[model samples]
Target: MKKIILTIIYILTLSGCGLEQDSYLVRWWNGNIPTKLSDKKEKIWDICFEETKYLPENTKEEKEKADMELNNCLHEKGFWD
Candidate 1:
């Protein structure tokens, strides 16, 4: 009985509410974007989504690198706002 309860708890924890609709990468991007990039929000988001959408969110360092790369891509495209 305890094993069954533990299994149920693990399943519930893994499959948290709204996990399908919003990905970890998307949430991270949404939270980490600089305020200066807000004026051109749509295009910035598009670049970010397009460039980093396929990146693996496995570690904090990877995520930070992805964010830096996204910012660099935006700056390279001259999309300052």
Candidate 2:
């Protein structure tokens, strides 16, 4: 019984691990953008998604809003893929 409960809990935790389409981890850009040229882009991406300041509250709705805000910023800067 204990092993079964532990397995269930582990499964629940693993199920929530995923990357959203817009996530930097998912590589939204097309083709290979050299690291040299992508420094500024990387910084912006970090500020928008990786930084806690721009992440909004920890709620799902707040995260979605923040993600959209970041996507808009990237789009305005001419990054679309």
Candidate 3:
């Protein structure tokens, strides 16, 4: 029984370690505006877009700034160019 409990605990711990969050975004430019994004390459673009919705709306500037920051974060994590 003790061995079974230990095994279960070990399995749970390992599973938790495997469930990692994707926290990166890649970007590319097209024409005069930037286009394309890969949030950790998992196709979580909608989630990423939602997360960036807090940007100011005075101009496209705020959105652009957020995109740049997200791109940098992805690059630092070796997930973007």
Candidate 4:
């Protein structure tokens, strides 16, 4: 019984860790052209797009807005420098 409990705990731990993984890319557009962005500015924009995509579908509009703000912030922060 103890071994079974330990196995279950291990599985749960692994699953929980997976939840924190960042698999999305940020973008200025809704498209998934991650490779097209070569410059640092474009990359920052893509990161914004990816982050928005990772959010829940119900808040897509909000996420998109947030992504735009992120892009602006990146530019202001001299991402191209």
What are the C-alpha RMSDs, in order, of all predicted structures? Answer: 10.0, 11.4, 15.0, 12.2
Q: Order of candidates by TM-score, top first?
A: 1, 2, 3, 4
Question: Which regions of candidate 2 deviate over 4 angstroms?
Answer: 1-37, 43-52
Q: Which residue pairs does candidate 4 place in steric collision?
A: 25-50, 26-46, 26-47, 26-48, 26-49, 26-50, 27-46, 27-49, 27-50
Candidate 4 — which residues are off by over 4 angstroms?
1-58
lDDT of 2 by residue, 10-67 (tens): 9977864775655664453544334553777776666555534546658989988877
Model 1 scores a C-alpha lDDT of 0.73
lDDT of each: 0.73, 0.67, 0.59, 0.64
Error of 4 at 5 (Å): 51
The number of the candidate with the highest lDDT is: 1
> How far off is model 2, as Cα RMSD?
11.4
Q: Candidate 3 at residue 52, lDDT?
A: 64
lDDT by residue for model 3 over 1-81, one digit each (tens)?
Answer: 999999999997887675434312211122344445555554444455566667675669977898876665545556543
Q: How accurate locally is residue 76 in candidate 2, as Cα lDDT from 0 to 100?
A: 69
Candidates, ranked, lDDT: 1, 2, 4, 3
Q: Report the C-alpha lDDT of model 1 over 1-81, residue by residue, as the tens digit.
A: 999999999998886754654676556646953344455766776966798777776899988988888878877766664
Give the least accurate 10-residue stretch of model 3, judged by summed lDDT.
Answer: 22-31
State model 3's lDDT: 0.59
lDDT of 4: 0.64
Superior by lDDT: candidate 1 or candidate 3? 1
Q: Which scores higher on lDDT, 3 or 4?
A: 4
